[model samples]
Target: MKTAICYYSRHHGNTLRVIEAMAEAGDAELIDVTARSAVRLEDYDRVGFASGIYGFEFHRAVADFARKYLPQGKPVFLVYTYGGAKGAGAKAVAKIAEERGCPVLGEFGCRGFDTFGPFKLAGGIAKGHPDALDLEDARKFYRSLG
Candidate 1:
């Protein structure tokens, strides 16, 4: 089945690394939310919403994309990269998907380098994270979703 990943990867580009790895294995398209509008869900069989945590939430652009477009009855999933595990970007997106009548197939996350403002002062916690190992795991995870 065809799939698409709609996301925003700012600050560290960590989320994109994971999503790109996944896309390589899955027949999925990647849409950078900053560079495009919400995509037509009918073009794909499934959708994945991915992004980095920002201010304890999903990136504003991703949130807006979800709010603006989420196809009805589509299978959806979420992936996020975060500095710490406490944030709820994945949870928030999952809720949005559910509310939109999309069945959530699965969700995944990886620890990523953090460079959001003060987080960069320390040269990024989890430096070099979302590394090759993480990318491989993400690809495996997405493949399983198929």
Candidate 2:
């Protein structure tokens, strides 16, 4: 299927790394929400939202993009990177997709080196993460989407 992933991966670029690995493993279009305000998804068969966890949610840009542009009943999936936990951001995004009548295919998440907030004072956490193994796992997750 032709897939498009709208994502926001600022700070450490951890989310970007995972998204890149997934795209490399399959035919997918990567959309940086920060670079573009609006996108047309009618040509894509599936849509994905990816972001680094920010305040226990997907980045604002990603959430806003989905709210504004995601098509009704489109197949949707989520991928995220976090320093402390997983699923929170995915759940939030999934809810949005569900409300739009999109069937959520699945979700994938992993640790990304986090230096945000107070963690920066302690030299950060999950250092060196979204590493080789994490990237491989992302590729596997992408393959599973088929």
Candidate 3:
């Protein structure tokens, strides 16, 4: 399948690890949301939106992309990485995709090293995360979509 991954990975690039592994496994195209203001979904059969959790939500730019430009009636998936396991960024993305008439194929996420704001005080949790096991899990998740 022709797939495209739209993602935003700022901080320590923990979230980007999963996206990268997924792309490499699937041979999907990768679109960095920071570089591209909006994604044109016409080029791919499936679109995956990936991001790091920010305050229990997907990043503002990613949310904006989903709201303003994600194609209607397409199949989409969500991939999120967070320091803690309690957030709903993946659920939020799935909800947005559904609202846009896109079928949610699946979601894949995991706890990644977090070193932002308050978390910085302790150096970071799960340091060096999005580790080998997480990457393998992500690869499997992407493969399962087929």
Candidate 4:
């Protein structure tokens, strides 16, 4: 499959670990959405939108990018990392993709190191997360997709 994963992983880079393992295990393009504003998805047979959850959603830019530009009628999947089960963001973004005619594949998530807002007071949460086991699970998840 010609696939691409567009992601945003700031802070502790916990989310990056998962995708890097996944990318290394599979054949796919990994795009860090935070570093660029525009992306071309035309060549991909499958596309993924990944992010770190913020306030029950993905980074605003990621959500907006999916809502605004994710190609219609394509197969799209989701990946996320969060401090808690707050990625109600996935549902919102999935709905947007579905409305645009993108077929929903599935979703995957794992806890990432979080220090946003109040959590920052404690140094961090889920430190060293998206660790070896998490990365292995992510690799399994990608293999399962086939």
lDDT of 2 by residue, 63-126 (tens): 8888899889999999999998654677777888889999999889999999988999999999
* Model 2 segments more than 4 A misplaced: none
Which one wins by TM-score: 2 or 3? 2
C-alpha RMSD values across all candidates: 1.4, 1.1, 1.4, 1.5
1-146, model 4: which lDDT tens digit per residue? Answer: 99998888886777777888888889889888767777778789988888888788878777777776688797998888988666486887788887989888888899888888888999878877888888889998888877
Clashes of each: 0, 0, 0, 1
TM-score of candidate 1 to 2 decimals: 0.92
True-structure RMSD for candidate 4: 1.5
Q: Candidate 3 lDDT, tens digit per residue, 1-146?
A: 99988888887787788888988887888888879755678778989898888889788778777777687898998888888853667767788887878998988888888877788899988787888999999999999999
Please report, in order, the local distance difference test score of every candidate based on alpha carbons: 0.84, 0.90, 0.84, 0.83
- Give the TM-score (vs. native) of candidate 3: 0.92
lDDT of 3: 0.84
Q: Write candidate 1's Cα lDDT for 53-130 as tens digits.
A: 887778878877877887788899899988875366677777877788899999888888886678778776878889
Local lDDT at 126 for model 2: 96
- Please tell me which model should have the higher lDDT, number 1 or number 4: 1
Candidate 1: worst-modelled 10 consecutive residues by lDDT: 84-93
